[model samples]
Target: MFKHSKFAAVAILAISAYHGAAFAQDAADPVVAKVGGVEVHQSELTLAMTGLDPQLANLPEEQKRVAALSAIIDVKLLAADANKEGLQNDETFKQRVAYLTDRELHNAYFKKHVVDSVTPEEVKARYEKEIAAIEPQEEVHARHILVKTQQEAKDVIVALDGGKDFVELAKEKSTDPNKSEGGDLGYFTKGRMVPEFETAAFALEKGTYSKEPVQTQFGFHVIKVEDKRKQAPPTLEQVQDQVRQLVMRDKYVKLLEDAKAESTVEIEDPALKKAYEEVNKQQADQKPQQQ
Candidate 1:
């Protein structure tokens, strides 16, 4: 019962798009199955395949086709029986059909206006604006010698001060996996490390190691700062998809706000109405208009 309901919901969601798409080709979608004198065409089978539950979607391609065909056959048989019983004429079914039709139309409009309307130039502009707003942060390229005991960390610091190579000492004394690379942590900003370690590392000048061991949850660290510089912004290609989503969201919110302003929305329950208003208020507070 639950499975059937899920498929019905998916089919309803696809209805408008399917209808618009069905006219694109003049070639016939041959009848693949029949039930109670009702024929199921290839187009209907394709819709059924598109609407399969995610769990069933993972099946082999041929098996997926067979499963979709089976589901469509069942739907046809049950629909024919319902029609025979005049269930199609029932008021409840009529109301449901109306709601499903409106929902599908809503999806079609959203696809056309929000999804299709987004352009590459708009995404790039949004990315540039967002990137410009980010404050530059200093990042450090550092290495460390991590040891189980503070005394061990102190010994490593002594090794550094005595002009022993940090990388060799790290490989010999440190327990961290990066010890093989001389405990190289590459470049990172302050928030990336624990408070104690970050404070100690950031306090050091380039080319200096901590004279004393710094303790943290990971044990003790003999820290050094190899270099420090401003962090770089991500490449456009790396953030293009995310920026496109931001563009879509902004468009959707504007459409909803305009629609809400023109329409009457009344919640009969006072508590539910209050909750709805609060949600809208929170959304408004969280994101500023992109422009």
Candidate 2:
């Protein structure tokens, strides 16, 4: 499956915290501490909390900020020594800094162009379009009297034939944990049960009990079909978040395509180039081909 880079997820987390810091800066961004004459911004606390030790995330919020402050102070103390030693001038360190800066920029761009651009109306329209394409499925509401042996199952069918109340009979004779609820499985579509049980349940007419015992890995069942109807689609409220993710994914792909069109990418290694093309193909495939 195609997916955005893991770095993108980290970037999103970092950018989201920074986004909040914008409006909350005056109230929340004041200097909480100083290290070696350098001020520590409350905004830095967000990066420290997210980018530093993973353990800090488990700490209570106030304690987390205090730890992050201490950690950042320690980093500054060592970073000052590294700077004094001219480590920042080293070629490897410079390259690492450049790469990190580029990654952070990419993350911020992704957040601004892709994540923030998704709207509720677009998500709802996409959801409705997807839902409309699906075929409605038939589901059955069933109750089953399960027993250890075929004879027990057959006897339950005979009792049902004698017009015994299915619910009361299930409570009296079934060993299932749900026996208290009359062996009621409620409503389910096909493929939700063992093949034997699902087949028998769907085959029985509504309001009728299976004439014969149905055997499955669970033993024998005397299933009674209570009702059948078209399974209802999930409500928009139940799946809005997921549909929003789909909208974001499509937008990200479009953004990538636009950027790729404007840039020059030359790969000298043939094998690496082929592999890169394959990955891009997957990304391209994630969006439907332009009509």
Candidate 3:
């Protein structure tokens, strides 16, 4: 992952605290503090708080701003000393500063084109589209008596056929952990359980018990279907964050695709050149499936 020095980190943190409109930097940009005779603007303080330390983020808004201002002040003091010592003129320091500047620019561009550009309306539309694409699945509520031997399972089925209570028989004879609850498996869609158990359970009508034992790796099971229904789709409120991310991803991909088309990209290294072409070829091959 990428990380900034304490100096660059604090600077970005301070700048992030400022409001979007504060970028205008008119007469409204007030001096929040002075460090080593250099004024720190309100925009800088605001921007810093945007990426406050995790612990500071939970603090009240005013407290967070104060903390960010303190950090900026510390950075400014150290930066002044570094400048006095001519450290800023060092080749290594210059290179670090260049990298930090480009990373900040990249962050700003990503914020504008990817994060901030995703609107609530776009998110909602994506959520509806996702909901429309869902296929209905049948879920079953069931209970079972799992036994070590097929004879024991068959005996359980015979007991049910003899008008004995299924739950009572299950509680007495089942080896499964849910035996205490008469082996109640709750509700599950297909593919949730072992193949044999799932198949036999799903084949039975509601309120019907299996006439024969269903064998699986675990053991033999005599299952009864208590109820069945189509699984309900999740509400928008339950999936709003996921939908928003999907919308943002789609937008970012399109933005990158357009930029790639208008730009010249080359990899001079032979190994990397081959890798890059293969990567792009894979993406291009998936275009038809994605569409």
lDDT by residue for model 1 (74-166), tens: 887888889999999999999999999999998999999999999989899999999999998999999999999988988887777788999
| Candidate 3 local lDDT, 140-210, one digit each (tens) | 99999999999998888888888999899889999999999988999999999988888998999999999
For candidate 3, the lDDT comes to 0.87
Which is the leading candidate under TM-score? 2
- For model 2 the local lDDT of residue 245 reads 89
RMSD (CA, angstroms), candidate 2: 13.4
- What does candidate 1 score on TM? 0.84
Q: For every model shown, what is its TM-score relative to the native structure?
A: 0.84, 0.87, 0.73
Tens-place lDDT per residue, model 2, 214-262, is: 9998888999999999999988999898889888988888888788899
lDDT of 2: 0.89
1 versus 3: better lDDT goes to:
1
RMSD of model 3 against the true structure: 12.1
> For candidate 1, which ten residues in a row score worst on lDDT?
19-28
